[model samples]
Target: MPRPPRGAILAVLAAAQFTVMLATSIVNVALPQIRAGVGLSDSATTWVVNAYGLAFGALLLAGGRAADLLGRRRVLLAGLGVFGSASAAAALAASPGVLIAVRAVQGAGAAAVAPAALALALGLHPPGPARSRALAVWGAVSGAGGAAGVVLGGVLTRAWGWPWIFHAVAIGSFAVLTATAACVPAAARTERARFDLIGTAVSALALTALVWGVASARRAGWTDPAVLAAFAAAAVLVVAFLRIERSAAVPLVPPRLFAAREVAVGNLLTALFGSVWIALFFFLPLYQQQVLGEDPLTTGLGQLPLAAANMLGASLAPALVRRVGSRTALLAALLTEATGMLWLSRIGAHGSFFTDVLGPSALVGLGLSVAFVQLTGLSVAAVTGPDAGLAGGLVNTTRQVGGAVGLAVLATVAGTVTSHAAGHQPPLEALTAGYRTAFALGAAILAGTAALAALLVRRTPADGPAHAPAPQPAASGRP
Candidate 1:
C-alpha cells in the first residue's frame, strides 16, 4: 500500500503535539479560580500543577519505548484516548483531589503521545529540505501552542468558566484523536523487541523521585529531610537503572543512543533552554498581575506579541539553518535570548507593556523558536528505525527535568529577594528587584548554554551530499 501524504500526517501529528504542549501551560492561568472553586489550601493548590509534571517526566522513557515496541500509531491512539477522557473527567471534577488525579492521568497520556508523535513525524518525512521544513512547522506549533495556552486559558476561564479550559482541551484532543485514527499510517511492529520491565521500573522511580523532590523544594526547603530523602532515593535508583541497562537484553535506554555528539549536545542545550524559558513564562505573568495590576485577560493579550514572533522565528529557522548552519544558528539564537533576558531584567515598578515587555518578549520568543527547531533536528539527526522514539523521548525528558529544577530555583530566588527587599524598600520596588534578579540570572544561564552549545554541537556542512533516509521495517497501514 502507498504511504499517506506527508503533509496530512504532519498536520495530524502536529495537532497532537499542540494539545500536549497546550496542557503544560493552560492550567496556570486558571490556578486561582481552581483554588477558589475547590477550596484548596495554598500548598495543595500547587499539586494541581506538579502532579502533571511528575507523571509526564517520570514516564517519558517508558512511553518512548512503548511507542517503538507497540507501534507508534497504536500508542498514539491510546494516548489520545486517555488524555481526552481525562480532560473530560477533569472538567466535571468537584474536588481538588479529583482534579489533581485527572491531571496526572492527563500527563501520563502526554508522556505517551509526545515521543510517538515526534517519531511518527520523522518516519513519514525523508531527511533533507522536506524534513527540515517539517521540523520547522513542528517547532513552531509546539512553541506557539505553549504561549497560546496561557492566553486561551484566560479567555476561556473569564468568558465561560474555569472548567471550560478542560472542556476545550477535551474537545480538541478528541477531534485530533479522530483525525489521527483516520489519517496517520501505522508503523511496522517487531515481536522480538520487548519492553524492558526492570529498566522501566527503576528509571521511572528515579525520575519520579527526582522530579518530586525538585517540585517540592520551593515549599519544603532543599535541606528538608523529605527533600533529602527523595534525592537520595533517586540517586540510588539511577545507579540501579544504569546497571540494569548495562546487562539487559533490551535496555529501556540504550547507551549507544547518547554516543552521537548531536544527540548529547542537543539534549544539554534543551535542558538549559527549558530552565530559563519555563521560568520566564511563569514569572513574567506574576509581575504583570502583581506589579502592573493587570487581569488575566490582559496578561494573556500581552503575550500575543511573543507568540507571534515565536511563530515567525520558527518559519524562518530552516532558511537560517541553511545560511548559517545549525551550530551558528543555535549560537545566534542563544545570544538573542540572553539579550532579551537582559532587556527584561530592566522591568521596574513603573513600566508599560510596550516599553518594558513587548520587545524583550519578542526577542526571547524568536530565540526560543530558532533554538528549539534546530536542536530538535540535531537530536534525531542520525538516529533511525526503532530508536527514533527513544531519541525524541530523551530530548523531552531532559527538558522537563530542567524545567522542574528551574521552576524551583527561580521561584526561591525571586521570593527570597522580594522578601528581603520588602523590609528596606517599597512593595513595588521590592517585587521589581526580585524579578530583575531572576531575569539577570536567566540571562547568565543562557550565555553559559551558548558557550556549551558552541563547544559541543558541531556545525553541519554548508554544502554536503544528500543522505538517504533510514529504512523502517514496519508495515505502513492506513486506517
Candidate 2:
C-alpha cells in the first residue's frame, strides 16, 4: 500500500488521543443521570468513574511495552476494537455492575491506545522544531478533549440521555479505528528481548492497589482498615517490582531512564500538573451546580471560556519555548496556574459565574495547557527508538496516579472542613468554604511545583548546549 500523508496519520492519532481523554471526563457531568438510569447508589456511581481510571492507570506500562514489541500500529488497532466494543456495550448497559465492568474494559483498551498513539505521533517528526510543533498540536487536542467532554456530556445527557455520551464515544472510536487501519502503516518488530511477565504483573498490581486505596480513602476514611491494607499491599508490590526490574535481563522499565534529569524532573512536574488539572474539572462543575444552582448544560456551556483559553495556550507554547526556553516558560506557566487557583480560593457561596469563575477558569486553562505541552516535551526529550512507547506510558502513569492522589487528599480536606463549618454556616456557605480550602491548597501545591522545576529542570532538548543526545533509532522498528 502507498504511504499515507503525514497530516492524515496525525489526524487519526489526534482523534484517538482525543477519544481517550474524552472518556476520562465525559462521565463527570452525567453522573447524576447515570445513577438514575442504572439505579446506582452514591458509592457505586463514583465507581463508574473510578473503575475506568484504575484499569487505565494499571495497564499502561504493559501496553506501552506491547506497542514496542508487537508493533505500534497493531496495538493501536486492537485497542480501538476493544475500546469501541466496550463503549457500545456500556451504552446498552442497564445494570450498575455491567456498566462499571464495561467501563473498566474501556479503560483497559485505553491503556493500549494512549501510549502507542503517542509513540507514533512522536515518530512522525524528528526531535526539533518539527517535533515541538507536533507536540503543540497533541497538547492542544488533549487539553481540549477534557474540557470538551464536559460540554458534550451536558448537551448529550440533557438532550438525549446519558447513554448517548457512551454512544458518541463508541461512534468516534470506530471512525478513528477505520481511518487508522486505512492510513497508518504497519511496522515490523525490531527487538527480540524477553518480556518481563513478573515485572508487568507486580507493577500493574502495585499501581492498581495504590490508586484504589487513595480513591477509597475519600469515602472509607483514611484510617479504615481496608484502605490501610491496600496501601500496605501496594508498598510491598512496589518493592518487589523494583527488585524484579533490577535483575531481569529485559526489564519492563529500564532503571537508567530515571537517571536523565529531564525524565525525572519532567515527570515530577507532570504529576503535580495532572493532580490539579483533573481536580479543577472535578470541582468546578460541582461549584456551579451545588452552590450556584446552574443546571448541567448551563454549567458545561460556562466552561467554554476555559476551553478556549486552553487551546490558545497550547497554540502559543512552541513560540514561548523558543523565545524563553523550556525551564523559564514552565515556571511562568506554573505560576500562572497557581495564581488562578489563588483567585479561585476566593469564590463565594452566592457568587455568579462571571464574578467567581470566568477569570480564574481562563487563567487555569491557559496555564494548564502550556504546562502540559512543555512537560510532555521535557519528559520524552531524550528518548528515542522503541523506548518511546515506554516513555509515553511512564509520563501518563505519573499523571494519572498523581490525579488520583491529589483528588483523594483534596476531597478529604474539603470534607473535613465542610463538616466542621456546618455548625457555624449555612449549607451553601459551608460547601463554598470547603471548596475555598481545596483551591487554596491546590495553589500551594502548584507554587511548590514551580519552585521544584526552577531548581531541578536545568535543561531541555530545546536548551542548546545542556541537552543530552537522544539514542539512535534501531534499524527495523518505528522510533
Candidate 3:
C-alpha cells in the first residue's frame, strides 16, 4: 500500500489516542449511577476506576517493547480490538465485579496502543513544524477528547444510561480500527530482538502491588500487613527489573532514559499532572453528587469551563513556546495551575461552579494543555526514528503512575479528614474538610512540578546530545 499522507495518518492517530484517553475520565461522570446500579460500597468504589489504572500503568514499558518487536500497526490494531470488545463487555456487565474486570481489560488494551500510536505519529512526521503541529494536535486531542468524554458520559448516562458510554466506545473502536488498518502506512519492519520477559513480569507485579497497597491504606490502615508486603514486593521487583535491564540483550526500557534531563522532568510532570487531574475529576464529582446533590449530567456540565479553556490553550501553546522558552512556559503554567488549586482549597459546598470552580478549573485546563505540549516536545526533541515508542511510553508511564499515586494520596488525605470531621459535624461540612485537604495537596503538587521544571529543563535548548543520529531498524529500543 502507498504511504498515507501524514495529515491523514495524524488525524486518525489523534482520534484513536483521544478515544483511548477519553475513556479514562469519561467514567467519572457516570460513577454515581454506576455505583447505585452495581450495588458497590463506598470504600470498594475506587477499585472500579483504579483497576483500569493498575493494569495500564503496569504494562506500559512492555507495551512499548511489543510495539517495537511486533510492529506498531499490529500492536495498535490488537489493542483497539481488545479495548473495544472490553468496552462492550463492560457495558453489558451485571455486577460491579464484572464491570471492574472489563475495565481492567480495556486499560490493558490502551497500554498496548497508546505508545505505539504516538510513536507512529512521530515517525510518520519528520522533526520540524509538521512534527510540532502533529504533537500540538496530540495535546489538544488529549484534553478535547477527555472533555468530550465528560459531556458524552453525562449525556449518555442521563439520557440513555451509563452503559451507553461504553456502547459508544464499542462503535468508535470498530470504526477507528478499520480506518487505522487502511490508513496507517507500514513502516520498514525492524529486525526482531529478544525482550526481557522477566523484567516485564516483575515490573507489572511490583507496580500493581505498590499502587493497590497505597490506595488501600486509606481504609485498610497504614500498618496493614498487606500494605507493608506490597511496598516490600514492589521494591524487590524494582531491583530485579533493574538487574534484568542491565543484563538483558534487549531490554523493555533502557536505563539511560532516566538520565535525560528533559525526559526525566517531562516524565515527572506528566505523572504530577495525571495525579492531580484524576484527583480533581474523581473528587469534584463526588462533591457534586454527595455534597451539592447534583445529578451526573449537571456535574459533568460544571466541568465545561475547564474543558473549553484546555482546548483553547492547546491550540495556542505551540506559538507561546516559540516566544517563551519551554522551561519558562512550563513554570508559568504550573504556577497558574497552583494558584487555581489554592483557590479551590477554599471552595465550600455552597459555592456555585461558575463562581467558585470556574476560574480555577479554566486555569487547570490551561495548565494541563500547555504543560502537556512542552512535555511532549521535550520528550520527543531528542528522539528520532523508532525511539519514539520508548519515549512515548515513558511519558505515558509517568502519567499513569502519577495518576495512581495521586489518587491514593488524595484519597488517604480525604478519608482521614472526612473521618475526623464526621464524628461531630454534618455530612456536607465533613465532606468539605476532605475536599479542602485534597485541594491543598493538589496545590503543593503543582508547585513542586514548577520547581522541578525550572531546575531540570535547560535554558539554552538542544534536543540534548543524540544517543544516535538515526537508529538501526533493530527491535526493542527507545528514542
How well does candidate 2 match the true structure in TM-score terms? 0.97
lDDT of 2 by residue, 270-341 (tens): 998888888998999999999999888998898899989999998988888877777787889999999999
lDDT of 1 by residue, 1-479 (tens): 67668798899999999999888888887889989988888988999889989999999988888887778888889999999999999899999889899999999999999999998887776577777788888889988888888899888888988899899999999999999988886544446477899999999999999999988888988899999999999999999998999999989998878766667877888888899978887888888888988878888788889999899998998888777677788889999989999999999899978888989999999998988887787778767656888877888898899999988888889889999999999999999999999999999999999999878876566432111223332333311
lDDT of 2 at 61: 92
Clashing pairs in 1: 188-474, 188-475
C-alpha lDDT score of every prediction, in listed order? 0.85, 0.89, 0.79
Q: Which stretches of candidate 1 lie above 4 Å from their native place? A: 1-3, 463-479
Q: Model 2 clash tally? A: 0
Return model 1's CA RMSD, one decimal. Answer: 2.3
How big is the positional error of residue 318 in model 1, measured in Å on the Cα after superposition? 0.5
| TM-score sort, best first | 2, 1, 3
RMSD of 2: 1.7
Pairs of residues clashing in candidate 3: 387-478, 387-479
Name the candidate that leads on TM-score.
2
